[model samples]
Target: MEVIVDPINSAVETLMSGTNTLFILLGAIMVLFMHAGFAFLEVGTVRHKNQVNALVKIITDFGISTIAYFFIGYWVAYGATFFSGAAELTQNNGYDLVKFFFLLTFAAAIPAIVSGGIAERAKFNPFLIASFFIVALVYPFFEGMIWNGNFGYQAWLEATFGAAFHDFAGSIVVHAVGGWVAFAAVYLLGSRQGRFRNNKLVAFAPSNIPFLALGAWILTVGWFGFNVMSAQTIDAISGLVAVNSLMAMVGGTLVALMVGKNDPGFIHNGPLAGLVAVCAGSDIMHPIGALLTGGIAGALFVFVFTWAQNNLKSFDDVLGVWPLHGLCGLWGGLAAGIFGTTTFGGLGGVSFLAQLVGSLTGVAIATLGGFIVYGAVKQISGLRLEPEDEFQGADLAIHKIAASSMDD
Candidate 1:
């Protein structure tokens, strides 16, 4: 019996043939799973009464981001760039698909940021509305200018500086965006009741360690896709990216263990810190470099978390999004400039000056944009739940349901 293979169509083939698309699809799935991680992490961090609310918010934001990105965000970010038939956005090679996937991941992040701000008491409707704006309009615009081939600011940077700003995955775009927005939301929402009775900090331990651990693991796995898929090329670069990501995570874990003096919380979050730190340079860094970067990030997480809790009085980053995602993302981006290989050629290589500019630019954009949107929303609609809701819990007040059946 003779088996016949259909003629390979190049147009359709390019989309799926290379490592590009495969990496992208894998990244998308990995990032998607991070939502579960977020849910678990946030639920574990907050009071039992707010568990349902936290999970619901994460799930709803993800759903909204998927739909919004597919329809408007994707087109605006990638599809809209094509001029005539020559510039049509190709999906098979995974650029457009990657953009779509990244948008969803981006969406997951924004709500995660807000989770800390409105932890114990947030009205579901307001939260949902805020999510819509972030995913639909706000995120796409910035991402379009950065990663979208047709319209990204990277094109401008490449033309002007002779090299484009590097963000291997999204140390700046995804994580920082969420952090700044979360900062605004929390500021507007005000501190949790009795959080500071006489200008002193209070302790709010996580109720479920198992959930937090699961979430951290999920994020670790997802990060592999996040870092590797950013490299559109399928050569040694991809492998390097994966290796760097792993090394950094391992390094971060070790550092956290040493710094925390055997504390599980610090260790639990070390992998994530490592991933975030290496994200900016995953495609360029060697394995050893990745380990060093990750280790620093892990150590930083311990300090930042503690600092934020103690020193940063107004900012209630419930899951430590600002430190874990925002600060670490910035570190990764800057690190890329310092550590990026000149040997790689093209955008993967960078000078220290260029890296500094790019890192600052990312911070400026995220901070300014976040402050504006969050402030406006707060002024117009009042961004927090009623005091009554705070004492009772948002799950019951907003959703009229408990996170688990036990509450019922």
Candidate 2:
């Protein structure tokens, strides 16, 4: 039989693939733009003297993360190295290339999260070096296990628990891991200069509320793409994911307002906590479930942030990223199981035991990785600035420029 080549069918396939590629590319750009949000949030939260350093660190980390992820991290996570000619790479309408870009944005978030926690005092070069390793190895190992099912982890989980670990977008994989890792860095770096004086807590006010609010808004807007676009293909897209994100955002905002006593910082960060929590089960959970999960996350951020700062004298997490990303990420990871079951009006394909084990696994890896990475760097090159330099602020100490020096 002579098979006739069908041009029309081939054309349709090409169009659909092209459309999916465009969708994911846009999502990657949106997530990439959230790095600006991360920068501004740090800039606003830190003192004016550290503002310039805050902005510089995030952008610099992004550049390094791009290099690391492109050359090494991508291969580690998906077993697909980009060591081929450009023509071969562009064959699938550049779909694989764009997918790398999207996933790279996610991997880069680790340093961005760590930057906030270790703000104002870290040596820039050492932090960058640490971030390079994290992107290249630490983050990708867990990413491959959960997202790509490397090393038979997913299969083991499925066989043991009747359901594999389910992180629809990366609550445990990205946000939780980033958060916990940041905690280790913060702990190792020690409290900032004058953050605790004679056993007294010193409050360094945020430099710019408007900038912080702006950052929050930008992150909130960009998060839709982060959650919904995880579908990665047109056929898998779900409006329910979008709606769940919206509900969770609002739930978090309201709870933060109430729990934080209307504090503007908490108010701004509220939506983010919610969005972080909802990321795990946005696909399977109902909007109400997402709302509940988000509300709890917001409350946790407000309360844990306050408690951690007050009680943990050695720890000085500048933007409360530990609570927002770490603890809330754990909650989100587990919440997926509670809210994603058929009994809860969700599309069921989850196991709570699987979630607990997987979430704990992510935590263990992140904490160990963060401690090992930061500890090694600390022992070798040191993590913090000198007392005099720290007192002078990072902008002057490292960059030789203050945020504003009109008189100079």
Find the candidate with the highest lDDT and give its number.
2
TM per prediction: 0.87, 0.98
lDDT of 1: 0.74
lDDT of 1 by residue, 175-224 (tens): 76666667666666666776766789988778798888888888888777
lDDT of each: 0.74, 0.95
lDDT comparing candidate 2 with the true structure: 0.95
Model 2 scores worst on lDDT over the 10 consecutive residues at: 1-10
Q: For candidate 1, which ten residues in a row score worst on lDDT?
A: 1-10
Predicted candidate 2 versus true structure: per-residue lDDT over 111-191, tens digit per residue? 999999999999999999999999999999999999999999999999999999999988999999999999999999999
Q: Residue pairs in steric clash, candidate 1?
A: 15-92, 15-93, 116-318, 145-152, 145-153
Per-candidate clash tally: 5, 0
